[model samples]
Target chain A: MTVAAEALAGRSARRRVRETVVTHVCLVIGVLIFAFPIYLALIGSTHTSGTIGRGDVPLLPGPDAVANYAQAWGIGGGRFMGVPAGGMLLNSLLMASLIAVGKIAISLTSAYAIAFFRFPGRMVFFWLIFITLMLPVEVRIIPTFQVMVSLGMTNSMAGLVIPLIASATATLLFRQFFLTIPDEYVEAAKIDGAGPVRFFFDVLLPLSRTNIAALFVILFIYGWNQYLWPLLIVNDRSLETIVVGLTKMIGSGDAQNEWNVIMATAVLAMVPPVGVVLLMQRWFVRGLTETEK
Target chain B: MATLTLSGVRKSFGATAVLHGVDLAVRDGEMIVVVGASGCGKSTLLRIVAGLETATAGRVMIGDQDVTALEPADRDVAMVFQNYALYPHMSVFQNMAYGLKIRGLPKPEIIRRVDEAAALLDIGGLLDRKPRQLSGGQRQRVAMGRAIVREPKLFLFDEPLSNLDAKLRVQMRAEIRRLQKRLGVTSLFVTHDQVEAMTLGDRLVVMHAGHAAQIATPMEVWERPADTYVAGFIGSPAMNFLAATLEAGGAAARLADGLVLPFADGSRAGEAGRKLTLGIRPEHLRPQTGGLRVMVELVEPLGAESLLHGRLPDGAEMTVKLAGAVHADGVLEVMPIAEALHVFDGETGRRIEPLG
Candidate 1:
C-alpha cells in the first residue's frame, strides 16, 4: 500500500510539473511578442543609417550606438531644419512637466470645489467640465488655436501646455477620489480651526498624496506624447518637442532619412516617462487599491 | 469651559426640516448627551453647536458670545467624530498638534500641549505612529487627545464611541466621562445608545422626530419621561406601552382587557373616559398570586435574571424581568407596581401628570 501511494504521488507530481512547464512556455511567448518591437528598435538604434537604409533589419545591435545617439542629441538630422535634439528634449521636458503640474493643480481645486462645496449651478458646472472629456484636443484644435492666438500665447510654452491641460480626465479622477474622503475629515478640520483654504492645504492635499503621485505618472506620459498640438502651435524649430521633432526628422517623404538617430531619439524620449512610472510604482499600486474612509 | 445655549435652533434642507426648533441650555463644565434614533436630528443639533451647520433661524451662544453666524474655525470649538477622524497621514503627535499649529501657536507651545495631551491619554509612546498603525481604541484615544490639546470652549462628540466593540465601548465611555469631568470642558455628546447617554452625560436630551422630547437627568428621564416617546426610548427592553382609558377621574387607567391599574399619586388632570397609554418598564412587573393573567410565549435566562415575554388577555405583548429563575408553565400572573406606572394621553402621547 505504501509503494502504491508513492507511485500515485509521483504521477501527480509529474502532472503538476508538466502544467508548470506549459504555463511558463506560454508566458515566455507572450513576453517576447510584446517586447519584439522594442527589441528591434534597440538593435536599429545601434546600427549606422546607411546600413539600416539598405533594408537589412539587423537582429543584433551594431557598434554605431555612440555615434548615432551623439548626432541625434547635438545635431538633428534635417539639412536646413536641423533642430538640435537636445533643445527638443528640453522643450518636451518643460512642456510635459508644466502640463502635469498645471493639470493637477487645476484639477485638484476644481475637484475640491465640486465635491466638497454646495452652491448654485454646482452640478451644471461639473457637467460643463465633464463634457470636455469627450471633446479631445484634436476635435477642437482650430478653436483652441484661435483662442490661444487671441490670448497672445501662440508659439509659446503656454499654448503647448495650457490647451492640453483643459481635459477633464484628471479632474474626474480627483473628484471620484475626493468623494471617497469621509465627511468627518472635513468636519474635523473645521472644528480644528481650519478654514477652507487651510483645510485644502493641510488635510485635503496631504490625504491626496498617493492619488497625486499616480496621476502625475499618467499626466506626464500624456503630456510627453503630445504630437498634434505642438506640431500645430510651434512654428520655430527650437521650440519643437521631441515627439514632433522625430516626425520632422523623416523630412517630408523620400528625403534619405537618418533612421538610426531617430530610433536613438525615440529611446531617449521614452526614458523620462518610464523612469517616472518606475519611481512612482509603489504609490501607484497603493493608490489604485487602497481607499481612505 | 463655557455654557452653551441654543434657542429655537431650526434647520431646513430645502423644504425638508431636519431640526424643528431645538432649544437646549447646557451649564458650564457640564456634559449633555443628545440621544435619539437615526434621522432624529441629534447629530444635526451637535453640528450646529460645533458650527458645522447653520441653523435656519436661531441663535447659538457659547459662553457670552453669540456664535450663530461665525464659521467653525472662529467658533473656538473642537469635535470628535464617530469614525475618530484622525488624519490618516498625520502622526499621533501631529494630529493632536494640528489645530494649534493652524492657529499659529508657537512651536514649543504646540509641542508641549501635544505632549501633555498624549500623556494624559496614555498614548505618549505612540506619538510617532500614524493613525492607521494604531488599534481602534488607540485611534479613539488619539481623537480625544486631539480635542483635549485644543482646549476649545466647547467639545462636540458625534457618537464618538459608536464605532468601538462592546467591551471597548464600555471602557471608553468611562474614560470619556472621567476625562470630561477632570478637564471640566463643556461638552455636547450625541448618540443613539441609551446606555451611553445614561452613563456619560450629566443631563440627557431624548429627541424624537425633530423635537427635543425630553431633557433631564438620566434618572429623571428614565423614571419620569416627559412623553410616551421618551418613555419608550429610554430603557432597556423599552417601556411597555398599553392602550387604556382614564377612569374614576384619572385615578385609574383601565386596559382593554378589563384590568384597571391605579395611580400611585392619586388622581391625574386628565378627563374621565379620555384615551390614555399606560407605560410600565419591564423590570417594574412582579409576579403576584392574584394579578393580571398572561400567557408566557418565551423565556430568556440571563443567569442572575430572566426575562419573561408574554401576552396579556387582550393580546398586548408585555415583558417582565424576574430575579433568578422560576419554574413555571406557559401561563403566569403578574402585576405592575403602582408607583412605577406611567400614564400618557393616548392622542398626543404626552405624559399625564398627577395633580398637585
Candidate 2:
C-alpha cells in the first residue's frame, strides 16, 4: 500500500510540474506578444531617422538616443507638427486629470442622489441617465460638437473635457456600490447628528476611497487615449493632445517622415497613464473586489 | 436622562400600515424592550422613536419637548444598529467622537469624552484601530461606546446584539444591560429574541401584528400574559393551548375529551357553555394517577430535565416539561396545575379575568 501511494504521489507531482511549465510558457508568450511593439518603438526612438528611413529598423539601441529625444521634445515632427512634444504632453496630462476628476465628482454625487434620496421622478431621472449608456461618444460626436460650437467652448481645455465627463458607466458602478451600503449606516449617521452634506463628506467619501482610486486610473487612461473627439474639436495647434498629435506627425505622401522623433513622442505619451496604473494598482484591485463596509 | 412618550403613533407606507397607533410611555432611566417575531412592527416602533421613520399621526415627546417633527439629530437620540454601523474608515476614537465633533464640541472635550467612553466600554486599547480590525464583540463595544459618548437624552438599540454569535450575543446582551443601567439613560431596545427581551429589559412591550400586545415587567408579563399570543410568544417551549368550553358556572373548563379542569383562582365572569381557550405552560404539567392520558411520542432530554411531546386523547398536541429522566413506553398521565392556567376568550383571543 505504501509503495502504491508513493507511486501515485510521484505521478501527481510530475503532472503538477508539467502544468506549471505549460502555464508559465503561455504567460511569457502572451507578455512578449503585447510588449513587442512597445519594445520596437523604444528601439526606433534611439536611432536616426535616416537609419529608419533606409528600412533598417535596428533591434539594438543606437548612439543617437539623447539627440533624437531632445529634438522630439523641443521641436516635435519639424514642419509636419510644429507644437513641441513637451507642451503636447502637458496638454494631455491636464486634460486627462480634469476628465478623471470631473467624471468621478459628477458620478459620485449623481449616484448618491439616485441611491439615497426619494424625490419625484427619481427613477425616471436614473433611467434617463442609464439610457445614455447605449449612446457612445462616436454616435453623439456631431451633435456634441454643435453644442460646443454654440457655447463657444471650442479650442479650449474645457471643450475637450466637458463633453466627455458625464460617465454613465462610472455612475452605474457607483450607484451599484452605494446600494450595497446597508441602510443601517444611514440610520446610524442620522442619529449621529450628521446631515446629508456631512454624511457625504465624512462617511460616504471616505468609504469610497478605493472606488475613486480604481475609477481614476480607468478614466485617466480613457482620457489620455482620446483621438476622434480631440481631433475634431481642437483646431488650435497649441491645444493638441499627444495621442492626436502623434498621428498627425506622420507625413502622408512624398515627404520624409520623422519616424525617430514620432517614435520618441509615442514613448513619452505612454508614460503618464502607465505611471498612474502602477501607482494605484493595489487600490484598483481592492476597489473592484473588497468592501470595507 | 429623559422619559420617552409615543402617543397614537401610526405609520403607513402608501396604504400598507406598519404600525397601528402604538402608545407607550417609558420611564426615565428605564430600558424597555419591544419584543416580537418578524413582521410584528417592533423595528418600526423603534425607528419611529428614533426619528428615522416619521409616524403618520402621533406626537413623540422626549422629556417635555415634542420631537415628532424634529430630525433625529435634533432629538438628541443615539442608536446602536444591529450591524453596529461603525464608520469603517474611522478609528474607534473617531467613530465615538464623530457626533461630538459634529456638534462643534471643543477638541479637548471631544478627546476626553471619547477617552471616557472607551474606558467604559473597555475598548481603550483599541482606540486607534479601525472597526474592520476588531472582532465582532469588540465592534459591538465600539458601537455602544459611540452611543454612550453622545450622552443623548435617549439611547435607541435596533436589535444590536442579533448580529453576534450565540455565545457572544449572550455576553453582549448582559454588557449592554449593565452599561444602560450604569449610564442611567432612558433606552428603548428592540429584539426578536425572547431570552434577550426577558433578561435585558426592565419592562417588555410584547408586539403582535402591528400592535403592542402587552407592556409590563418581564415577570408580570410571564406570570399573567394579556392574551394567548403573548403567552405563546414570551416563553420557551411555548405554552400549550387547549380548546375548551366554560362550565361549572365559569369556575372550570371542559376539554374536548370531557376532562374537567377547575380554575384554582376565583371564578371568571363568563357564562356557562361559553367557548374558552385554556393556556397551560409546559412546566406546569405534573404526573398524576387517573389524570389526562398523553400518548408519549418523543422525549427530548435536556440534561437536568426532559421535555415530553405527546398528544391528548382528543388528538390535540401537548408538551410537558418534567424533572429528571422519564421512560414512558406508550402512555403517560399528566395533570396541569390549576392555578397556573390562563383563560382567554375563544373569539377575540383576549384574556378573561376572574371575578372578585
Candidate 3:
C-alpha cells in the first residue's frame, strides 16, 4: 500500500465518520424535541402539588399520582357546579363517538356514489360539497351557533355531534381512493349476477378495509380532541368535555396550585387519540402509495 | 353455449358514435374474433353483449331470448377484462367460485366447479394464492378460470393478452385458442393484433371507425379483403399500396419508382389516367428477372425470410418480402405479378373488378 493512497483512504474514512456523527446527532435531537413534551405531560401528571408547582424537571415521577387523579375528579374542588369529572368524561365520549361514526357512515355512502355510479350532476354535486370545505369552520361559527340554538340543541352534546357530521374532506379523500379500483372488478361482479347492493358490499367495501381504517382513525382523533366547538356548545360545567373540564381546574385551591390534577385529566384525554394513531400506523404510511395500480 | 345475434345495433356517446348500425350472427359453439384499431368499436359491441353498455338503438338476442335491456348479471354472459381485473382481496379459489357462490350453488358444487376450472387452466396449484402473489401469466389464467367457472351462455374477452410480455402473450394466445376449442363454447374475443385474430377466431369480423368493414373466415379476409382499409389492417407488415389512374387494357398502378403495375382490371377500358391505387402483398412483389425496377435502400433479413425496403420511380417508399437472403446493394428487380395484384379505385379506394 502506498502512503499517499493510505492517507487518501484515511481522509475519506474520516469524512464518512464525521458525516455519520452529524446525522446521528440530528436524528437524536429531533427525536428528543418531538418526545420531550409528551414526557413532561406524563411526568407532571404524577407529581405532588408542591413538586408540580416547583416546575423544575422531575427526574422521576412523584408518588401522589393516585391522589392527584382523584382530586382532579373534584373530591376537593368544592361542589363543582352540579356533577363531577366522571359525568363530564361520559359526555365527551358520547359526543366524540357520534361524530366519528356519523362522519364515516355518511362519508362512505357519498364516496361510493361519487366514485362508482354515474348520474346526472355528479360532478356538480361533488364540486358543491367540496366548496364547503373551503369555508373555514371559524367563518361559519355564527351560522352554526344560530342553527344549533334554533334547534334547541344548545348546552347539549347534540349541538356538538350533528352539525359537524358532514365531512367533505374525508369524503373527497375516500372518493379518490375508491376511484383507483378498476371498473373491471365491478363489471366482473355484475356479470356474475350480483346486483348493485351486493356489489357494493361484497366487492367494494371488502377491498377498501385499509382506506376505511385509516379514515376512521383520522376522523376519530379529530373528534376526540375537538376543543372550540365543544367549548362553545357546553356552557354548564357538568356538560363540559375533557378539554374544557381540564381548563377549569386552574388556581384550583390547594396548599399549592394542583397542576398535577389538571395534568392527570389532560393525560386521560390523550388516550383515545394515541390508541387510534398506534392502531392505524401501518395504514397511515401506506395510504399514499397503495393505489399505484 | 348459445347463438348470439345483433341486429341494427347502434351506440353513441353524445355526438361521438362508437358502434354504427350493424348485424351479426355468431353461430352456437363457434369462436368469433372482432379485430380492429383502437377506436374501432369492437370493445363497445362486446360490452353491449355483456350488458356493461346499452346499445343506443336495437336488439341483441342470445339464444332464443332478447337480453338487450337486462343488466350484465341478468344476462347470461361472462367477460374477461384486458387488465385481468382480478379481485385483489380474493384468492384464486374464491375468484373462480365467486359467480357460483353468488348463484347459491352448493358448497360441494362450488368447490367442484372451481377445481375443474382451475385444473383446466393449469392454475389448480394457485387456488389459495391472492392475485398479488401471482405472476402476470398466472393472474391471466386465474381471470380465465373465473370466467370458466360461471359456465355462462357466452364468454367475451377484451384484449386479455395486451398486458403480457410478447413471448407470454403468444403462448397464452395459443392456450386460450385451445381452451376455447376444447370447451366449444360460444365466444367473442376482441383484439387489435391481426395474428391473434387470425389464429383464435373461427370467423373474423374486421371493423374500421364504427363499421364492420369485412366479416368472413380468417383465410377469406386475408385472401380477399373488402377494401383498402381492410386489406391494410388484416396483414402484418401490412399490404403495400400504390397510386395511379385506371388505363385502357388494365389499370395503371403508377409507382414512385417510375414503374406502373399493369393490373388486369379492364372494367375501366379507355379510362386511362383515372385516379387509382394498386394494392399488393409484400410477398407478391417478387424479386425476379422481369417487371419493374426498384432501388433497394435497406434490407432487414429475418433468418428464413427477409424484407426489402425500396422505392419506386415515383418516390413512394415500398417494402417487399424476399425469399431467403438477397445480396442486392441499393439495387434489386421486382416483378409485380398481375394475378396477385389487387386494384382499387383511387378516389373511393374500393376494389375494382377485373374487366378481362
Say which candidate scores most in TM-score. Answer: 2
Candidate 1 displacement at residue B141 in angstroms: 0.9
Residue B23 of candidate 2: its Cα lDDT? Answer: 91
Tell me which of candidates 2 and 3 scores higher on TM-score: 2
Runs off by more than 4 Å, candidate 2: A78-81
lDDT of every predicted structure (CA atoms) = 0.89, 0.93, 0.82
Highest DockQ, which number? 2
Which 10-residue window in model 3 chain A sums to the lowest lDDT? A74-83
Task: Write candidate 3's Cα lDDT for A210-286 as tens digits.
Answer: 77777777777777777788878778766788766666666545545566766777777777678768978888656
Q: How far off is residue B226 in model 2, in Å?
A: 0.8
Looking at candidate 2 chain B, the ten consecutive residues that score lowest on lDDT are B266-275
| Candidate 2 residue lDDT tens string, A117-230 | 999999998999999999999999999999999999999999999999999999999999999988888888888889999999999999999999999999999999999999
Q: What is the lDDT of residue A263 in candidate 3?
A: 73
Model 2 vs truth, CA RMSD: 1.3
Candidate 1 lDDT, A1-293, residue by residue in tens: 69999999999999999999999999999999988988888898999989998997999989999998898888877542467788898999999999999999999999999999999999999999989889988899999889998998888887889888864988999999988889888888887888889889988998899899888888989999999999999897778999998887775665877889888888888888888899999998877787654
Arrange candidates by DockQ, highest first: which order?
2, 1, 3
Ranking by TM-score: 2, 1, 3
Candidate 3, B1-356: lDDT as tens digits: 89999999899999999988978999999999999999999999999999999999999999999999998888878889999888888888988888888899999999998889988989988989989999999999999998898898898999999999999999999999899889888999999999999999999999998889988999998887888998999887888888766545554555544556665534554466777777889888776765556788988999888988888666777788878987778667788777778777778777776655
TM-score of 2: 0.98
What lDDT does model 2 reach?
0.93
Retained true contacts (fraction), each candidate: 0.85, 0.88, 0.88
